[model samples]
Target: MDLSNIDLSKFDGLAFIWLDIETITGTGVYDTLSSPDTWFVHKNPDVCEDFICSDLKNKQIFLITSGSLGHKIIKSIHHLPQLHSVYIYCQDIARHTPLASEFKKIRSVCNKTQSLISQLAIDVAHICVNIGDQHSRLNKHKQALVWYERAFEKIKQHNGLTKNEFVNALKSKINISTLECQRFQQHRQQLGEGMNEVKYQHELLRQLLDVPTPLSSTEKDDKHIAATIKKIDEWERKNIQQIKTVAERVRQQLQKQINEINKVNKVKHDFRLINDELRQRQSEDDYVEADLQQWLERLQQLKHQLETTTISDTSQIDVQITDDIDWSSMVKLVESDVSKTWVRTREISMVESL
Candidate 1:
């Protein structure tokens, strides 16, 4: 198809896109669509209702796929209030015309083309415009500006776009951003008014509570009035005290959590430091743990191997483990800086060779 013949200049204020539903297999739409304006919405009954029928704004979507979809899926599009139009593009147009009519908002029914270079080129520019239109319709002017900027960038990158196109796109961006700022200010004003109303209501309640009630002057009513006043005062004081106690308890609990978090963080910090120090040590290969029984057993094994070997006494390395030792002196030696903490162990193959 010829791109020069395809006039996407008409996309100025319109929101529309093309979708190839044949590419959409299984339950959900193919998420790989390069354009944000177009989507490959698939049919899944068990999926969230919002994903199927919600989030779409005013736009025309062309489903470029052959064959009929499920009756339920076709009917589901009709429920979307934001859709301006839907177009079905099938290989055999006449065959699906009757089925296409069953769906609402379907404006045009057309045939699919073999080639799509021109269509792709048109989409590169118009997709952003369509997104902007949809955002504007939804009263999301801030989001619209984002799409407008993206459109501007697309135009900027394209070698064929003229200066007029650049200006128009920039103008669209400014207009949308301005409108969003205005809407934001109006929302802020509305919130302020709402807050003021609440304050007024609170003040009115305070005044009503503070106002003294009219009481009977008779002696019999005096005692009853005094008792009622005392009860109310007592209840008010207890309620106030309870609130303070609860607030203090909540603060204390929060502090405990904060302290625990700090302790954990400190431990993590120290562990990382120790690991870094260990990694920096060049003699890490020679590292060993001090164990008396293990060392003695290894020495005994070496002595047994020596006894079995047929070698000259001076040529062999001799290792010994005696049964008798001064326990207190050995303990003192270990406790002092004189005891060896690490010992090197030769490979088992070396011992066997001996």
Candidate 2:
């Protein structure tokens, strides 16, 4: 795909492309098509190939091509997932039928323009139905609903569809929309219940704010308390050592950057000569306005050099620390009986589900 030609702002979900040597501007085909949002016509086979390949966003492509060029383009692009269907438009349907039969993407070979238009409309509706079914199978409810709506609209526009087909498509769209609304209502109710539960929990925690003597004097309790403190102390010491090592490494890097800065200072030393010359000229009253302007230009050049100067092998370093702790598991420790030996918490629910 030639990604440079794509404008994401003008993205389309579907494209109708006609590839023929004849110009489509004056032809009735372009005007007959219902959706012109992403319609395209190409006289050159190479340009058609480029357009088909450039739609990398997986937009469905319905291609109408002359029989002479159909075989060439189909062989190259028929396997593409986005090339949904192809139709052969030529004077001799018999000649192209044998060729079209070889490819599964070819819907039909038609000689009459009216027949081609009717078939195209029918295929478009069916395409929407198939796409909607695929999305439904994948559990993409919102996307499925969108496709179903598209299908229903297409069916309504074409009278060739059977009464049952039109009614069924409408029902599918309505059912999906109804189910989506029910899901949203359930989600809102769940959120409300969760909020109430959180409020209740906070009230219970607040009641214990002034309470005391919760733990009885027992050796088991003392041991557990000491063990928890010991665990925290070990964590503190380990993290402190890690931080100190990281600090020392950063200090070494800073020293190297300072060395680079010293090199820049050496370059600044060369500018001192110009400064001295300017001072000498001023003191001796030997400088004209032009001389002052010349000296000012040199100073500007020196300023530009300093501002644009970059130090090699010196970039800002960032420190990243990873912490993996099950905070919920820690809460279990306070609730556990200290009389029994401490058992490390295991996230068995997640493992069992997996």
Which pairs of residues collide in candidate 1?
none
After superposition, the stretches of candidate 1 with alpha carbons farther than 4 Å from their true spots are: 1-65, 70-72, 82-85, 98-104, 113-142, 150-354
Weakest 10 consecutive residues, lDDT, candidate 1? 345-354
- TM per prediction: 0.28, 0.46
Candidate 2, overall lDDT? 0.69
Which RMSD values do the candidates have, in order? Answer: 39.5, 31.9
At residue 191, what lDDT does model 1 achieve? 99
**Clash number for every model?**
0, 0
| CA displacement after TM-score superposition, residue 299 of candidate 2 (Å) | 99
- Give the whole-model CA lDDT for all candidates, comma-separated: 0.49, 0.69
